[model samples]
Target chain A: MHYFIELFFSGLTRGAIYALIALGYTMVYGIIGLINFAHGEIYMIGAFTSYIVASVLSLYGYPLFATVIIAGAAAVVWSGAYGYTVERLAYRPLRRAPRLSPLISAIGMSILLQNYVFLAQTSDFISFPKLIPDLPFMDRYADYLGSSDVVILFTTLIVMGILTFIIRYTRIGKAMRATAQDSTMAMLVGINVNRVISATFVIGSGLAAIGGMLIAAHIGQINYYIGFLAGIKAFTAAVLGGIGSIPGAVLGSLVLGLTESFATGYVSSDYEDVFAFTLLVLILIFRPSGLLGKKESQKV
Target chain B: MLKLQNLRAGYGNIIAVDDVSLEVGQGEIVSLIGANGAGKSTVLMTISGVVSCLAGRVLLDDVEIQGLEPDQIVRRGVCQVPEGRHIFPQLTVRENLDMGAFLRRDKKGIRDDIDYVFTLFPILAERRNQDGGTLSGGQQQMLAMSRALMARPSLLLLDEPSMGLAPLMSKQIFKIIKRINADHGTTIFLVEQNANQALHIAHRGYVLENGRIVLAGSGEALLTDPEVQKAYLGI
Candidate 1:
């Protein structure tokens, strides 16, 4: 029973990270209907940006919390840049082309980005120092979950809240929703559809970057290859929740995260990937629209 | 005022609107009427900057706007109520209207305009919270017109505003368009397949066929002209 509570909290924390990254996938897909395979590399870039920032800040005698915040901010900026450039160079030109070409380009971009990072930085899995200050009640709190897990959960909730606020109230948010609903209507109404799409990518990538930083801080280590698997898992979560829904992404991530933890706990870890894909396949078969996704009707 | 000179537009090598030239003066309701594939809608799109013009010039009040982007054209007070009533399916009526004024910063005026639109189309007020996609076809047409009006545009381009509508509903929409013009004095350039209804309220009219302006005259004159009668009125 105690271990169950522990596993539950641990799963929730991991789910938060997945949810954050999955948002990028859902948001980009919502606007442009592209899978944006290179989005994962944005996650990888974010982790490295945070690692470099925090490490340098720590060496310069900055406090742990301060350094972590700065690193997190840097991660957000870098990931936003990554998303913007990818949209302008990789995806925008192919707007009128066949779908397959853009999908292939996205994959090519992923490979290119991963290799670029690998060449620029060392191939080794570098560690991000423990910059988050652990509370004194850490072990006592861990009767159910770790402090970092609590931090992840709280951060996810806050970010999700802010995101909801933005989507529901602000002008930019309205533009994004309009673009998602119908690009032509948005353009006709003077909503810069391209700008909205770019903003969606930026916001999504920024979220993923923030998540990457948090995960790196919690685990204290990361590598370039980390993004590939994490990206797949996040994509799975996005599709599982419904590719266009914000809440769906978070809920799907939690389910995927819990499933991963349990698979490792009760079964061989080797079967984790198989289990996630199996769940996705089942979802596709049983409820093709997704758990929360409302099925859209074709007008003509 | 909007003017087009020798406008040649196409979708690929197969030309849809060819070498068309026409003008819509300020504060007048001008209607473009033709059959399917007659390029009535294509002329509006080229003027609205949705489709590129292969050759010729588009001038809004003598400011050349031939190659401008769609949003820029819209920003210059040219709002297009697209064919098919392309309202954002997932958005609410309020959000759709807000997007019409997306580039504007006048908060109080925007609020007032929203109120006015509600008065113009009370059903939109009732369905303000409903998603635009779920509205009935007639209601969607109303929403699209309302959204275009939200921009307070100088030149409103309406493409097939009566499309997919019952006869009674189409009459009601046209009545509202007349009311909007009378009350606001907003210039209108309307496209429609239903030539009879389109010419009913138009101050002047142009007839497009095979991507060219086959005829142009005052609305009543064109409605009675022997050429327009044979070609468009099917008399």
Candidate 2:
């Protein structure tokens, strides 16, 4: 029973991270119908940003709490800048081009960003500073849930709540939803569609940056290539839940995280990816539109 | 208060609105009537700045607006309800109306306008919380117009407002169009393939043929003209 609880908490922590990253993919896809392949790089950049800031702040003798806050804020802002620039430079010019063209541009951007990061930051993995400290109350539950896991889960919940509120009631959120539904009509109603697209990129990048910071702190390591695998996994989660649906992304991530955890716990860690992918294939075969995706309906 | 001078625009290599010039005075209902391929929509789209104007001037009260972005043009008090009543499928009717007022910052005025549109189209009021896609065709038309009205536009460009609607619904829509104009004192630029009804309600009407304005006259004159009667009114 204890062992099962441990795996479950671990899976929940992983799901929280995946949900944060998957939201970026789903939101960008919802607005533009384009898979922002470079989104993962944004996450990597975020982790690196946090790493550098945290290291510098600590070196300057800043308190741990202040250091963590400053590091996380820096990560979000820098990642947002990168996200905005990526869209302006890579996707905006090809907005009217064939759908395949923007898609190709996205893949090219992903590769370019990865290489850029590699050249700028050494490929060697560096140990990340523990930004989350142990809680006094968590000492009793430490066997099942670590302090970092608790913080991650709690932060994700708060972020999700804030995001839901923004999308449901805020003016910019309504504009985003409107643009996603029918961009032409959105324009007719006086929405700056380009600005909305840029906002989407920035928001998605910011979320991924939070995920990057949390996961890097949890794992205690960072590298330029970390985003590649994490990005693919989060994308898989997005697709599994339903690419354009926000709630679907969260549900998909949880399912993916739990599956990986249980499969590793029961069978073997070596086949963890195999189980995760096989589940995705089965779900796709049965529901091509994904679990929560709306069926494609054409109006005559 | 809108004027177009030799407006030439279209897709790449194909001119949809070729050398079309017209004026819609403030508070007048001007209908541009034509057949399926006559470029009526292109004219309105160009004025709304959706399509790039290849060559020509689009002046709103003497201010050139041809090269501005679509949203910027809308910000200048011109709003369009394009063909097909493109309602946001997932948005509720009320939310759709909110989108119509996207640029407006006056919260109380927006609220009053929302109430005003609900009174104008009571059916929309009842379906306020329902997703727009689930509405009937006639209801969707009502929602689209109400959405446009939320902008409180000085000049409302309507493209094929009667298209794909039943005769009874079309009549209701036309009646509401006139009411909107009379109530708000708004200038209207209406584009339609349904010539008989458009001409009847219009103060002045222009006949477009193959991307060019072939004729212009008062509503009664065009309605009774021999050439217009033969080609357009199905007389």
Candidate 3:
């Protein structure tokens, strides 16, 4: 029972990271129907931003909480600006072009960002400092849970709660839902579809930044290429959960995380990727609309 | 209240509306009648800034609104109930109505407008919480019109409000359009394929053919015109 609980906590932490990344994928896809392949690179940028902020602020000898807060906030702002610029430069112009144009452009952007960061930051892995301090009571169950795990879970829950409130009750949220349904109609009814699309990218990228910062702090290391694998896994999670559904993305990430944890725990750790890929294929074959996706009929 | 002069607009190289000119006076309902592909809908779309005008001017109360963004056009009190009743399917009926007033900031006025919409279509009030997609065709049309009215526009551009409706429901819709114009003094520019019913209610009418206005006259004069009877009324 204790072993399983330990696995559950670990799985939850990993799932939280995947969920944050997957939401960026799902939201950009939802509003504009683009895969936003560059989303993973945005995550990488976040980690880099946080790392730079931490290094610069480390000179001040601030406490762990203050360092994490300042670093995380800087990462969010920088990453969000990157997201907005990416949309305006790469995605916005291709909006009216053939749908394939934007997909190709997104792939190009992913490559561009990866190379740009590699050239500027070097290809070597950078070690990250622990952002969360060890709490006194957590030492009692150190084998089962860590203070970092608690922090990740707490942040994820708070973000999810705040996002839910905004999406459900706010005016901008209603406009977003409306645009997702029918953008042409949304415009006719006076909603600025462009502004809504930009807002979605901003929020999604900010969430990804937080996820990047947390994952880097927890793992204690990051590389320019870390976003590639994380992006693929989160993309898989988004597809597993219904591609456009917010709750579905989180649920899919949890499922993916638990599957990975158990497989690594009981089976050969070398087969982790194989297990995840096989599960994705099986799910696609059995349930093409994903776990929670409703089969939508196109109105001709 | 609304004027389009020599408006030329279309989709990528294919002109849907070619040099069409028209006008709607305040407190009057003007109908633009045509067959499918005659540019009636395109004219409305251009005026509402959904489609760009290639070469011409769209003026709303002497203000050049051509080339303005769609939301900007709506802010200037030119609202369009687009073809096919393009209501947001996932949102509730009440939510759909609220979105119509997206630009307005007056909370009391918005509340009053919503109440007015409900009075216009009581079925909407009853189904305020239901998703717009769940409504039947005629009910959806009502919701679409009500949603547009939520903006409280001085000039309303209605495109094919009677399309895909039963004869009875279409008649009811026409009756409501007349009531809205009479009671509120809204300047209306209506586009419809159902020429007979449209002309019967309109104060003046324009006949569009092949992306141009082929004829224009008072509603009674057009109804009695020999060419109109032969081509549109199917006499």
Which numbered prediction scores highest in lDDT against the true structure? 2
Give the better candidate number (1 or 3) by lDDT.
3
Q: Could you give the candidate ranking by lDDT, starting with the highest?
A: 2, 3, 1
RMSD of each: 1.5, 1.2, 1.2
User: TM-scores of all models?
Assistant: 0.97, 0.98, 0.98
| Candidate 2 Cα misplacement greater than 4 A, ranges | none
Cα displacement (angstroms), candidate 2, residue B116, comes to 2.1
Candidate closer to the true structure by DockQ (higher is better), 1 or 3: 3
Model 1 is docked with a DockQ of 0.81
True contacts kept of 2: 0.89
**Full-model lDDT for every candidate:** 0.89, 0.93, 0.91
Q: Model 1 over residues B105-222: C-alpha lDDT tens digits?
A: 9999999999999998899999999999899999999999998898999898999999999999999999999988888899999999888899999999999887788888999999
Docking tier of model 1: it is high
**Model 3 per-residue lDDT tens digits across residues B1-235:** 8888999999988999998998889989999999999999899989988888999999888889999889888888889999999888888998899888888889999999999988989999999999999999999999999988989988999999999999999999999999999889988899999999999999999999999999999999999999999999998
Per-structure clash totals for the candidates: 0, 0, 0
The docking category that best describes candidate 3 is high
**Which residue runs does candidate 3 get wrong by more than 4 Å?**
none
**lDDT, candidate 1, A77-168, per-residue tens:** 98999999998999999998889989999999999999999999989989878866677777777688777887888888999999999998
How does model 3 score on DockQ?
0.82
